[model samples]
Target chain A: MKNLTLALAATIGFLHADPLPSWNKSDSKQSIISFVDKVTDAGSPDYVAPAHRIATFDNDGTLWSEQPMYFQAYYIFDRIKQLAPEHPEWKEKEPFASVLKGDLNSALAGGEKALLEMAMATHANITEDEFSKSVADWLATTKHPKTGIAYTDMVFQPMLELINYLRLNDFKVFIVSGGGIDFVRVFSESAYGIPPERVIGSSIKAKFEIRDGKPVVIKTPEIDLIDDKVGKPVGIHRYIGSRPIFAAGNSDGDYQMLQYTSAGEGPRFGLIVHHTDADREFAYDRDSHVGQLNKALDDSKTQNWTIVDMKKDWKIIYPEYIESTPSQ
Target chain B: MKNLTLALAATIGFLHADPLPSWNKSDSKQSIISFVDKVTDAGSPDYVAPAHRIATFDNDGTLWSEQPMYFQAYYIFDRIKQLAPEHPEWKEKEPFASVLKGDLNSALAGGEKALLEMAMATHANITEDEFSKSVADWLATTKHPKTGIAYTDMVFQPMLELINYLRLNDFKVFIVSGGGIDFVRVFSESAYGIPPERVIGSSIKAKFEIRDGKPVVIKTPEIDLIDDKVGKPVGIHRYIGSRPIFAAGNSDGDYQMLQYTSAGEGPRFGLIVHHTDADREFAYDRDSHVGQLNKALDDSKTQNWTIVDMKKDWKIIYPEYIESTPSQ
Candidate 1:
């Protein structure tokens, strides 16, 4: 009788368990739950087949903190430092010199052109395997500038739970990011439970060749797809070959993606992660240079997109680590 | 006693059932079974994880009949006839005029440039959904000129079983074709059980746009990736994000794909479908106008790729449709 009582209690606990434990009780959380329920329930009018249950998430600010500049920019800077000794001419090069001097503001003063130059210099010529290995190595040793935590660990706990929640409901989740594809693929599986094949992002052109009697795909110093803004929808059309029923983003960079997802036929869910928490995490939007959220935030109400107030909606910002305190 | 005896008989039959019933007892069939067994056996040294068991197949001649010109070429010609009323200028245009005149040789005399023009004319401007709808309609109404069968019905039965066999072994099957991605995606799922996301092929540039308050992906006239020959491996790298453990193809277009797959670490399988039966199917290889197989055929001996002789290996060339007989 005691064992039966314990078993019954355990069954009830399992049945009533919250999927998104980090998310507090709010409209933002309820919207997500209700959306999943409507789509997965066959008796509901908004029932979507398992094959059509594709959910896309923007990586930079939506899945993780993109503050203090994009994490990939830091990777490019680190790669420039690692490859600096070989390129003596880089000492006098404007962007390279500024990057080496540790003046990120001055280095980025040239804007997209300078960033593209640095990215190509470090990212191209090597085999795809080598490039991914370098990214994995840098991620293992490097720490975020402000948080002093591993970059992968800075992923939003609530968002992770949401991903798991949707996946549990038979949604095929994909990361449609503006970040480099190769760089994001290294940790996507370990961090987000998303695989490399499901990652669609910006990329450099690559060529296949036989080197030393072994096959290698060498990255070329040419831009391929820039999967940001309008390109996000194009990337989705080309890669996923279907419209996502659910989309999530944190900034205007994902404005078109949210627009496209919400425009799809049948029941659709669009989520905007508004960084409203200044105490728990860095909070800057609208006027902020990186991850500007003006247009998407303003249009969220008109678009029927759910706005996630980080400070209010989320109970925990980041996953708890062994060494760090909640205050950190 | 009867029930017990019948149950024992059914169990024995299930255990000894042949996975590839259409494939004759040949080295080609044995190689596939052995490779699958080696990779799936947990106690074997050559075992590969389920995630890494990716098997890619070329579409046109490898999976279906591509003898009387390419199948997509036929689709282009049909589309031109359907849209000829919109552009009266096409009636006098060189290639278009030849296509309208029913002179295929004259139309193709202008070579790749002429083919590209025809393809772009028929394929571009429409939304992706519209494009796929046209492909489906064409497949439904059109019949093969020589075989008098539906295009989807032209799929090789042996290859179909092989795909199913690999899928049963937990290998993810993908259609890596030289055909247009959109065109192949229309029938990939229904015909081969390969979904749109698993089909990687040649593509034209497309843009995401909003027209009349609806989101649409407009196909552009310009080319994106060709996904033929060397481009196959590049597509595999960019799309699949990893080298396939098993690769199958028919022509030289798949040479690099076979090479790349075989060169990967650990056990790998490469197969070449050689059409050698004039009575059963068209028989032309090294000197064929389409699907030239010279280079890959010669390299197969050194690469240790299994060669499937269509006539000798396959018990049936095509599936047993309601209207078709074994002689077909």
Candidate 2:
């Protein structure tokens, strides 16, 4: 009888030591565990073939905090300032002048077009190698405002655990983001364990040519594809060539991707990361300008998507900040 | 001593049974084997990490045969005829009329523009699901003209062995083709063991919308992207994100892809399948109307790209035809 009690205690202890240590033992966490268990169990009807076990995650708020505007926006703002010296007329220009003058809201008042112009100016017309190096250099030096930590160090501990868990279960995880492809690719592998090839995101047209006695692929300012909202599903179709079996996102940008994935003819899972912690992390949902979760939040209940409330569902948020490799 | 002798003789006989039975003992085959060995060997300075061991192959002439016009061109012609009763105006059209009248040469005289019109007509303006179904239906019934065998059965045996060998060495093989994305995806898995997610090809634009109380992504008639010539490298960049380490093709349409791949840092490989066997397969290059191999053929020598002479290198062109499954 003592031996039986000891065995039972050991089993209970093992069960409590779950894979997602940062996630609180909530129903949302349970749902993720249960779904993974069902899909991985070969004896169960939900068993998916290893090759088809694909899971995609949105990179911005879903993987890291997107508060105080997108981190890439800050990069673009800094880029505008850097280019201002070359463009002497920028002191009088509307968006560029405003950006250089430290008025971000006015610079963004022109909406997507202004943002796109900034993205094009900063992200294109250079060789692919130069752009990659610039992104890596920026990521190495940039820090989040509130946390005063490197942007890469602001990755969610819970999401990191989830990625590791999914990979362990034979799931090939992909980063499907609205951010620039190169921007996301710069640190995705180091921060999220997702390699550059598996990342699907917005792109600018690139031209392959021989120049200066060397073959080079150059990124042009022309927009090639967008991977947001309705475009997300289209991007997934074009890049992945198949719908993902699992998807997770934080905003309406990922609504269509989740719809496309869940609509597939098999058991699937969708997650919405709800920002609900005001102390540890900024909390905003319906009214937030950046990473707004409105339509997706409204439909999560109807669609049976797990709404992961940050305050309630997470025992820990970001990993302990560490700038391991200093490049710049 | 007799038992040991017998064992030694059996080991020697097994070793003599070559892995690539359809490939003759030629320089091209030796080059492929040697390159793969060097890259895969852990002790070698040329060793590449498993995740970076990407290999891309062109579909048409490189994998099978694209002799008497592309197989997809025949499918488009058949589709034009099948839809003729509905669209009576097609009978008076130059390209469509020529296609229906069985004058393939006159039909193709209109060149790329004419082919684009047919592709837009038959391959788009329907739901993605419907388009995929139509491709599958056509491939299920189609047969090669000379072999009278199912098109899927015409896959090259040596290429099959090479694919298997690469997979064994942890290389992720992808089909980077100029053919229709949905069309290649249908047979890629069954014929080559490459899943739909790994196939990258040309695609028409698709948009997501709600219809009949169900959401569906519909294929639009507008040409979204082409995956040939200079566009091949663009497609590879937009889909794979990372440049492939190894690339293979058989025509000028693949020139940019091979250049982009081989230009990358490290021990890269590029291969061109030269169609020199007129008796077994069609042989036309430099001045050929279809699968023209002009500039690429000339550049291969200077670029250090291995050119596989089909007549001298391949002992067997295609695998023995066998349709294991009946058409739907």
Candidate 3:
């Protein structure tokens, strides 16, 4: 009698275990389940072949915590400081000087031009191999300002589960982000289980040349492609050459990408991860400077896109880390 | 006694089934087989993991015949005439007018700039979807100038075998070509079993916008990345994000790509297809107007790269097509 009861309990447990444990049983979670089911179901009219089951995600806001500021922006700031000794002119320059002094507001005071100048100083004139190693080193050592945890640890627990679930259902997951491609690529394969080739993003130009009878890629400051807003769909068309069946984003930058994916033939899924947990994470959206989600939020309702209210929809905000402490 | 005789005959036939029937038994063929064996052998020190087994091929002259003129060049020339009715200026234009008059020599007199002008007119200023459809439609209807066979049928049989052989050994094959990415992608999967995502090449700028409340990609005339010579390595780095163990090409355009691949840390293989079979195919190399193979030909010997002599290394030049007729 005892053995039979144990077996019955085990079967029940297997049936009840949630694939996305961090995600609460809300309509947002329900929509995800329904879409995956419809696409994967052999009997369903919306069944898509595994080859065509492409799912793209906005990395910075959708996959991880882009709060405080974008994570890559933090890396770039550190790079500016590290590269200051070589570029003495940066000490007196407006943007680089501000960056060095830890005054971000003053640095970004000049807007996009200032950002590009800072980026060029730190991101270019180095071999690609060197740049990649620097990114890897920073990712290994850096901690999130608010979380007091490794930046990698700030990745949302729920998003990880969702990615795994999609992968299990034979969907080819791709990171189509506005972040620097090389920067995201260093950590993406290890952190998010997305390969380097599958990640697409903004990139600076790189020149290939033979130096001392050896091949080396020299990254130049010239902006190659800005893969945000209108550029996302173009990047998708250029790189993947196929329309994604599922798209996820958290900002207006992803508006066109979502629009492109949803407009494709047959059933498509669009999702937004709305920052609603002020206590655990952030609360601002439309007014926030980083990852502003204004037009996309309003469009979500009309488009029937699932909006995950992080406070109610996410049972947990981030992965547990050794140094993490709850805000009092 | 009869059964024993038959068994002996079958065993003899099995030993010489010829995996690459179009390739003659030569050092070039031996080098390819040896490299593949070394990389795939689990016990060998040079053994590469399946994920890292990337092999890139240059498409035009390497995989298929680019004789007389490039097959796509023919397509572009035909498009100029087809589109001439809409643009009255083309009737008197230098390159366009020369193209319409069937004066190939005068059309190419201005060189690369003239080619770019033609490409921008026919290859851009339309939706990517529409351009793809146009290429597909042309491929379906058009035949090669001399062969009377579909252009797709002109693919080199030995190269196809080599691609298949690499795939069988768990290598992921990619096409890194000077040709437009979209143009190669249309037939790559069907002809070579390499998907669109696996092909990287030159591109023109594109814009994403909402048309009639629907998102679409509009190709612009501006050049993006030119995937030739030095650009090949840059494209490979940007797309694959890893150095290929094996690289193959047929001209000076692929010199840097071969150099990049051969310079990697591990045991690398570089092979060049030298067109030498004048009887079976066009044999111009050093003095050829298209796919000029001058400097790289000298570099191949020093680098120890395999140079495949079409006359000596290949038993057949092209794959037999349904309507293929021997050139009289």
| Top candidate by lDDT | 1
Q: Looking at candidate 1, what is the lDDT of residue B59?
A: 99
CAPRI grade of model 2: medium
What digit string (tens of lDDT, one per residue) describes model 1 on residues B85-180?
Answer: 999998999899998889989999998789989999999999988999999999999988888888898899889999999999999899999999
Candidate 3: which stretches are off by over 4 Å?
A: A1-21, A320-328, B1-22, B320-328
Q: Candidate 2 lDDT, tens digit per residue, B120-222?
A: 8888767777777787898888887776777777787778888887898899899999998877987899889988878888889888887676567788898
Q: Is candidate 2 or candidate 3 better by lDDT?
A: 3
Q: What pairs collide in candidate 1? A: none
Cα shift from native, residue B266, model 3 (Å): 1.4
Model 3 per-residue lDDT tens digits across residues B216-318 = 9989999998999999999988887778899999999999999989988888999999988888777878898889998889999888789999899986777
DockQ winner among the candidates?
A: 1
- Of the candidates numbered 2 and 3, which has the greater DockQ value? 3
Candidate 3 lDDT, A1-328, residue by residue in tens: 9967755543443344467766777788878987888899999999999878999999987898897888887888999888888889988989889989999989888877777777777888887888999999998988888877788877888898999999999998999999888888888878888888889999899999777768988889999889999999998988888889999999999999999998989999999999988898888799988899999999997887889899999878787553266532
- Indicate the residue-level lDDT of A102 in model 2: 95
Interface RMSD, all models, one decimal each? 1.0, 1.6, 1.0
Distance from true position, residue B214, model 2, in Å? 1.7
Candidate 1 deviation (Cα RMSD): 3.7
Candidate 2 wrongly placed segments (more than 4 Å): A1-17, A320-328, B1-21, B320-328
**C-alpha lDDT of candidate 1 relative to the true structure:** 0.90
